[model samples]
Target: MKQIQTDFINKLGIGAFAYISISEFCGLFEYVFENILIIIKTEPKIIIWLPGIMSLILFTVIVIWGIKKFNKPIEIDTRKVLNSLIYLYFGILIAQYLFIYFGTDFLTEKYSAEFDFYNKANKGSLMLRGYLANIPILQFVVFGIILLKNRKTVANNV
Candidate 1:
Protein backbone atom coordinates (compact mmCIF):
# COMPACT_ATOMS: atom_id res chain seq x y z
CA MET A 1 0.00 0.00 0.00
CA LYS A 2 2.83 2.39 0.76
CA GLN A 3 4.49 1.57 -2.49
CA ILE A 4 1.22 2.09 -4.32
CA GLN A 5 0.77 5.48 -2.76
CA THR A 6 4.28 6.53 -3.67
CA ASP A 7 3.75 5.37 -7.23
CA PHE A 8 0.52 7.26 -7.43
CA ILE A 9 2.17 10.45 -6.22
CA ASN A 10 4.98 10.09 -8.71
CA LYS A 11 2.53 9.54 -11.54
CA LEU A 12 0.48 12.52 -10.49
CA GLY A 13 3.59 14.68 -10.40
CA ILE A 14 4.55 13.66 -13.90
CA GLY A 15 1.02 14.25 -15.13
CA ALA A 16 0.88 17.65 -13.51
CA PHE A 17 4.20 18.62 -14.99
CA ALA A 18 3.10 17.57 -18.44
CA TYR A 19 -0.17 19.45 -18.11
CA ILE A 20 1.49 22.67 -16.88
CA SER A 21 4.29 22.46 -19.43
CA ILE A 22 1.83 22.13 -22.29
CA SER A 23 -0.13 25.11 -21.02
CA GLU A 24 3.03 27.18 -20.80
CA PHE A 25 3.93 26.20 -24.34
CA CYS A 26 0.53 27.29 -25.52
CA GLY A 27 0.97 30.64 -23.82
CA LEU A 28 4.32 31.06 -25.50
CA PHE A 29 2.74 30.18 -28.82
CA GLU A 30 0.19 32.94 -28.29
CA TYR A 31 2.93 35.48 -27.69
CA VAL A 32 4.96 34.30 -30.66
CA PHE A 33 1.98 34.37 -32.97
CA GLU A 34 1.24 37.93 -31.96
CA ASN A 35 4.79 39.11 -32.58
CA ILE A 36 5.15 37.21 -35.83
CA LEU A 37 2.03 38.84 -37.19
CA ILE A 38 3.74 42.20 -36.82
CA ILE A 39 6.42 41.42 -39.40
CA ILE A 40 5.03 38.58 -41.53
CA LYS A 41 2.37 38.68 -44.17
CA THR A 42 0.89 35.29 -43.48
CA GLU A 43 -2.68 34.24 -42.90
CA PRO A 44 -3.50 34.98 -39.27
CA LYS A 45 -6.18 32.31 -39.13
CA ILE A 46 -3.80 29.56 -40.19
CA ILE A 47 -1.13 30.83 -37.87
CA ILE A 48 -3.50 30.73 -34.93
CA TRP A 49 -5.06 27.42 -35.95
CA LEU A 50 -1.76 25.58 -36.32
CA PRO A 51 -0.50 26.17 -32.81
CA GLY A 52 -3.96 25.78 -31.28
CA ILE A 53 -4.47 22.42 -32.96
CA MET A 54 -1.03 21.16 -32.02
CA SER A 55 -1.49 22.18 -28.40
CA LEU A 56 -4.88 20.45 -28.28
CA ILE A 57 -3.35 17.26 -29.60
CA LEU A 58 -0.51 17.43 -27.10
CA PHE A 59 -2.92 18.06 -24.24
CA THR A 60 -5.06 15.10 -25.29
CA VAL A 61 -2.06 12.80 -25.43
CA ILE A 62 -0.85 13.93 -22.00
CA VAL A 63 -4.29 13.30 -20.51
CA ILE A 64 -4.44 9.76 -21.92
CA TRP A 65 -0.94 9.02 -20.73
CA GLY A 66 -1.70 10.36 -17.28
CA ILE A 67 -4.84 8.25 -17.04
CA LYS A 68 -2.96 5.10 -17.91
CA LYS A 69 -0.02 5.82 -15.66
CA PHE A 70 -2.05 6.89 -12.66
CA ASN A 71 -4.64 4.15 -12.78
CA LYS A 72 -4.77 2.68 -9.29
CA PRO A 73 -7.39 0.63 -7.48
CA ILE A 74 -6.60 2.34 -4.21
CA GLU A 75 -8.02 5.64 -3.10
CA ILE A 76 -6.00 8.85 -3.45
CA ASP A 77 -6.59 12.47 -2.44
CA THR A 78 -7.56 14.21 -5.65
CA ARG A 79 -9.04 17.47 -4.41
CA LYS A 80 -5.75 19.35 -4.77
CA VAL A 81 -5.22 18.39 -8.36
CA LEU A 82 -8.86 18.95 -9.28
CA ASN A 83 -9.02 22.35 -7.62
CA SER A 84 -5.70 23.42 -9.07
CA LEU A 85 -6.85 22.47 -12.57
CA ILE A 86 -10.09 24.38 -12.10
CA TYR A 87 -8.32 27.47 -10.88
CA LEU A 88 -5.73 27.33 -13.60
CA TYR A 89 -8.40 27.12 -16.24
CA PHE A 90 -10.29 29.92 -14.65
CA GLY A 91 -7.21 32.13 -14.53
CA ILE A 92 -6.50 31.49 -18.19
CA LEU A 93 -10.05 32.38 -19.08
CA ILE A 94 -9.84 35.62 -17.19
CA ALA A 95 -6.47 36.57 -18.64
CA GLN A 96 -7.53 35.82 -22.19
CA TYR A 97 -10.74 37.75 -21.84
CA LEU A 98 -9.00 40.74 -20.34
CA PHE A 99 -6.40 40.71 -23.06
CA ILE A 100 -9.11 40.68 -25.67
CA TYR A 101 -11.07 43.44 -24.06
CA PHE A 102 -8.18 45.81 -23.33
CA GLY A 103 -4.98 44.71 -24.97
CA THR A 104 -6.13 45.37 -28.53
CA ASP A 105 -6.74 49.07 -28.07
CA PHE A 106 -3.59 49.47 -26.07
CA LEU A 107 -1.51 47.75 -28.71
CA THR A 108 -3.00 49.73 -31.55
CA GLU A 109 -2.66 53.10 -29.80
CA LYS A 110 0.88 52.39 -28.71
CA TYR A 111 2.09 50.83 -31.92
CA SER A 112 0.54 53.40 -34.28
CA ALA A 113 1.84 52.33 -37.70
CA GLU A 114 1.59 48.72 -36.56
CA PHE A 115 -2.16 49.02 -36.11
CA ASP A 116 -2.74 46.51 -38.88
CA PHE A 117 -0.65 43.92 -37.10
CA TYR A 118 -2.36 44.71 -33.84
CA ASN A 119 -5.71 44.19 -35.49
CA LYS A 120 -4.64 40.80 -36.80
CA ALA A 121 -3.24 39.81 -33.47
CA ASN A 122 -6.43 40.91 -31.81
CA LYS A 123 -8.42 38.62 -34.08
CA GLY A 124 -6.28 35.66 -33.14
CA SER A 125 -6.48 36.62 -29.50
CA LEU A 126 -10.25 36.86 -29.70
CA MET A 127 -10.47 33.34 -31.09
CA LEU A 128 -8.44 31.91 -28.22
CA ARG A 129 -10.27 34.09 -25.73
CA GLY A 130 -13.53 32.54 -26.77
CA TYR A 131 -12.08 29.04 -26.67
CA LEU A 132 -10.61 29.43 -23.17
CA ALA A 133 -13.73 31.05 -21.74
CA ASN A 134 -15.64 27.80 -22.04
CA ILE A 135 -12.87 25.49 -20.85
CA PRO A 136 -13.01 26.20 -17.10
CA ILE A 137 -16.75 25.82 -16.76
CA LEU A 138 -16.69 22.57 -18.68
CA GLN A 139 -13.72 21.25 -16.75
CA PHE A 140 -15.34 22.17 -13.46
CA VAL A 141 -18.35 20.07 -14.40
CA VAL A 142 -16.26 17.09 -15.49
CA PHE A 143 -13.97 17.24 -12.49
CA GLY A 144 -16.94 17.53 -10.19
CA ILE A 145 -18.18 14.18 -11.50
CA ILE A 146 -14.75 12.59 -11.09
CA LEU A 147 -14.58 13.95 -7.57
CA LEU A 148 -17.75 12.06 -6.74
CA LYS A 149 -16.15 8.82 -7.88
CA ASN A 150 -13.06 9.60 -5.88
CA ARG A 151 -15.16 10.25 -2.79
CA LYS A 152 -16.73 6.82 -3.14
CA THR A 153 -13.31 5.17 -3.28
CA VAL A 154 -12.21 7.08 -0.23
CA ALA A 155 -15.29 5.99 1.65
CA ASN A 156 -14.67 2.37 0.73
CA ASN A 157 -11.13 2.57 1.99
CA VAL A 158 -12.24 4.12 5.26
Candidate 2:
Protein backbone atom coordinates (compact mmCIF):
# COMPACT_ATOMS: atom_id res chain seq x y z
CA MET A 1 0.00 0.00 0.00
CA LYS A 2 2.72 2.44 0.96
CA GLN A 3 4.73 1.31 -2.07
CA ILE A 4 1.83 2.25 -4.34
CA GLN A 5 1.56 5.63 -2.68
CA THR A 6 5.28 6.33 -2.94
CA ASP A 7 5.53 5.29 -6.58
CA PHE A 8 2.76 7.77 -7.31
CA ILE A 9 4.65 10.63 -5.68
CA ASN A 10 7.94 9.77 -7.40
CA LYS A 11 6.52 9.08 -10.86
CA LEU A 12 4.38 12.18 -10.83
CA GLY A 13 7.38 14.30 -9.85
CA ILE A 14 5.55 16.06 -6.98
CA GLY A 15 2.28 14.49 -6.02
CA ALA A 16 0.25 14.94 -9.18
CA PHE A 17 -1.96 12.26 -7.68
CA ALA A 18 -3.29 14.94 -5.35
CA TYR A 19 -4.98 16.56 -8.32
CA ILE A 20 -6.71 13.29 -9.18
CA SER A 21 -7.81 12.94 -5.58
CA ILE A 22 -9.12 16.49 -5.60
CA SER A 23 -11.02 15.86 -8.81
CA GLU A 24 -12.64 12.71 -7.43
CA PHE A 25 -13.49 14.61 -4.26
CA CYS A 26 -15.11 17.37 -6.29
CA GLY A 27 -17.07 14.96 -8.47
CA LEU A 28 -18.56 13.00 -5.60
CA PHE A 29 -19.14 16.16 -3.57
CA GLU A 30 -21.05 17.81 -6.41
CA TYR A 31 -23.18 14.71 -6.96
CA VAL A 32 -24.16 14.52 -3.30
CA PHE A 33 -24.89 18.25 -3.08
CA GLU A 34 -27.06 18.11 -6.15
CA ASN A 35 -29.06 15.24 -4.71
CA ILE A 36 -29.53 17.17 -1.48
CA LEU A 37 -30.80 20.19 -3.36
CA ILE A 38 -33.16 17.94 -5.23
CA ILE A 39 -34.73 16.75 -2.01
CA ILE A 40 -34.94 20.19 -0.41
CA LYS A 41 -36.54 22.78 -2.60
CA THR A 42 -34.06 25.50 -3.52
CA GLU A 43 -34.74 28.92 -5.01
CA PRO A 44 -32.40 28.47 -7.95
CA LYS A 45 -31.08 25.43 -9.77
CA ILE A 46 -27.66 27.09 -9.73
CA ILE A 47 -27.41 26.02 -6.10
CA ILE A 48 -26.22 22.63 -7.31
CA TRP A 49 -22.97 24.06 -8.58
CA LEU A 50 -22.15 25.80 -5.31
CA PRO A 51 -20.77 22.56 -3.90
CA GLY A 52 -18.21 22.30 -6.69
CA ILE A 53 -16.91 25.82 -6.07
CA MET A 54 -16.72 25.43 -2.32
CA SER A 55 -15.14 21.99 -2.59
CA LEU A 56 -12.50 23.32 -4.97
CA ILE A 57 -11.60 25.95 -2.40
CA LEU A 58 -11.46 23.37 0.39
CA PHE A 59 -9.43 20.93 -1.72
CA THR A 60 -6.96 23.69 -2.51
CA VAL A 61 -6.36 24.20 1.21
CA ILE A 62 -5.80 20.48 1.73
CA VAL A 63 -3.24 20.28 -1.06
CA ILE A 64 -1.44 23.31 0.29
CA TRP A 65 -1.38 21.79 3.76
CA GLY A 66 -0.02 18.53 2.37
CA ILE A 67 2.74 20.37 0.57
CA LYS A 68 3.71 22.28 3.69
CA LYS A 69 3.47 19.39 6.13
CA PHE A 70 3.88 15.92 4.52
CA ASN A 71 6.21 16.30 1.57
CA LYS A 72 8.42 13.36 2.56
CA PRO A 73 9.37 10.83 -0.11
CA ILE A 74 7.63 7.45 -0.05
CA GLU A 75 9.95 4.46 0.49
CA ILE A 76 9.34 1.80 -2.14
CA ASP A 77 8.76 -1.62 -0.65
CA THR A 78 9.12 -4.85 -2.69
CA ARG A 79 5.81 -6.58 -1.99
CA LYS A 80 3.34 -5.87 -4.78
CA VAL A 81 0.08 -4.76 -3.24
CA LEU A 82 -3.20 -2.99 -3.91
CA ASN A 83 -4.77 -0.07 -2.12
CA SER A 84 -8.21 -0.99 -0.82
CA LEU A 85 -9.08 2.66 -0.61
CA ILE A 86 -9.26 2.76 -4.41
CA TYR A 87 -11.86 0.02 -4.51
CA LEU A 88 -13.79 1.64 -1.68
CA TYR A 89 -13.84 4.91 -3.56
CA PHE A 90 -15.37 3.34 -6.66
CA GLY A 91 -17.73 1.23 -4.58
CA ILE A 92 -18.98 4.34 -2.85
CA LEU A 93 -19.45 6.05 -6.17
CA ILE A 94 -21.49 3.16 -7.58
CA ALA A 95 -23.52 2.99 -4.39
CA GLN A 96 -24.21 6.69 -4.54
CA TYR A 97 -25.54 6.45 -8.07
CA LEU A 98 -27.66 3.46 -7.15
CA PHE A 99 -29.07 5.37 -4.21
CA ILE A 100 -29.93 8.26 -6.45
CA TYR A 101 -31.63 5.95 -8.90
CA PHE A 102 -33.67 3.83 -6.52
CA GLY A 103 -33.50 5.09 -2.94
CA THR A 104 -34.11 8.75 -3.76
CA ASP A 105 -37.30 10.18 -5.27
CA PHE A 106 -35.29 12.12 -7.80
CA LEU A 107 -37.02 10.63 -10.81
CA THR A 108 -40.48 11.59 -9.54
CA GLU A 109 -39.49 15.17 -8.96
CA LYS A 110 -40.82 17.69 -11.49
CA TYR A 111 -37.32 18.75 -12.57
CA SER A 112 -36.46 15.29 -13.89
CA ALA A 113 -39.92 13.75 -14.04
CA GLU A 114 -40.46 14.86 -17.58
CA PHE A 115 -37.51 13.07 -19.04
CA ASP A 116 -38.21 9.62 -20.44
CA PHE A 117 -35.31 7.27 -20.20
CA TYR A 118 -36.65 4.94 -22.86
CA ASN A 119 -37.37 7.67 -25.36
CA LYS A 120 -34.95 9.14 -27.84
CA ALA A 121 -35.55 12.75 -26.86
CA ASN A 122 -32.99 12.85 -24.07
CA LYS A 123 -30.14 11.06 -25.79
CA GLY A 124 -27.77 13.98 -25.36
CA SER A 125 -28.41 14.27 -21.65
CA LEU A 126 -28.26 10.50 -21.24
CA MET A 127 -25.01 10.32 -23.18
CA LEU A 128 -23.50 12.95 -20.94
CA ARG A 129 -24.51 10.99 -17.86
CA GLY A 130 -23.03 7.83 -19.31
CA TYR A 131 -19.74 9.62 -19.97
CA LEU A 132 -19.59 11.00 -16.47
CA ALA A 133 -20.38 7.64 -14.88
CA ASN A 134 -17.77 5.77 -16.89
CA ILE A 135 -14.91 8.27 -16.59
CA PRO A 136 -13.94 7.59 -12.97
CA ILE A 137 -14.09 3.83 -13.34
CA LEU A 138 -12.02 3.99 -16.51
CA GLN A 139 -9.48 6.30 -14.87
CA PHE A 140 -9.14 4.06 -11.85
CA VAL A 141 -8.66 0.96 -13.98
CA VAL A 142 -6.02 2.66 -16.11
CA PHE A 143 -4.10 4.00 -13.13
CA GLY A 144 -4.41 0.74 -11.22
CA ILE A 145 -2.80 -1.10 -14.14
CA ILE A 146 -0.01 1.45 -14.35
CA LEU A 147 0.63 1.27 -10.62
CA LEU A 148 0.65 -2.52 -10.69
CA LYS A 149 3.17 -2.57 -13.54
CA ASN A 150 5.42 -0.09 -11.76
CA ARG A 151 5.19 -2.01 -8.51
CA LYS A 152 6.03 -5.40 -10.04
CA THR A 153 9.05 -4.10 -11.93
CA VAL A 154 10.43 -1.97 -9.10
CA ALA A 155 9.70 -4.45 -6.31
CA ASN A 156 11.08 -7.48 -8.20
CA ASN A 157 14.21 -5.68 -9.46
CA VAL A 158 15.17 -4.50 -5.99
Best by lDDT: 1
Candidate 2 RMSD to the real structure: 9.7
lDDT of 1 by residue, 66-131 (tens): 444555465555656556665766677667667767876676666666657546556637756677
Query: What would the per-residue lDDT of candidate 2 be over residues 1-158, giving only the tens digit for each residue?
Result: 98677676554533344445556665667667755554455433244345555555555555556444543445533122223334545665676678678755655555453323222333445444544455555445644554565564445543
- TM of each candidate vs. truth: 0.41, 0.45
Clashing residue pairs in candidate 2 are none
Per-residue error for 49 in candidate 1, Å, reads 3.8
Stretches > 4 Å off in candidate 1 = 1-45, 72-74, 111-158
Clashes of 1: 0
Q: In lDDT terms, how accurate is model 2?
A: 0.51
Leading candidate by TM-score: 2
